[model samples]
Target: MAETKGLGYELIWKFDMPTTINHIMIMEDIQYGELIRKYKVEGKVNGEWRILTEGESVEHKRIQKFDKVEVRGIR
Candidate 1:
């Protein structure tokens, strides 16, 4: 292979959220005081999610359908 060089990036991604949102909580008669709480489990990666691009937030990055991501749950 020829001399190829550049920087790569690594990250961890969590896809699935834990408990589904169910109810809304209302404060003492205050308008816009209704609070929505959703329970979510902290997802973790078994390994680093590596990207060839440099210094990029992987959000919305088009990974291959089968791209390897170490996640604790299904999205």
Candidate 2:
């Protein structure tokens, strides 16, 4: 996948039946790197990660410093 210009952290997401464990909810069939639905991401989640073919809407965040990312999620 193409790297985002300002991606704070690299997360390996997995998909399932939308599991909510420890207050963290993960949607079904939604895998980015190592996370679930609604994550703190920078840049556009398309072109690079083609999760949605057309008319796709991804949730990404524009972060400045990597330190802002409290958790690394995964390697």
- Name the weakest run of 10 consecutive residues (lDDT summed) in model 1: 18-27
For residues 10-64, could you state the per-residue lDDT of candidate 1 as single tens digits?
2223344322222212223325452323222222345333232222222322232
TM-score of each: 0.16, 0.18
lDDT of 1: 0.29
Candidate 2 weakest lDDT stretch, 10 residues: 46-55
Task: For residue 34, give model 2's deviation from the true position in Å.
Answer: 21
Clashes of 2: 8
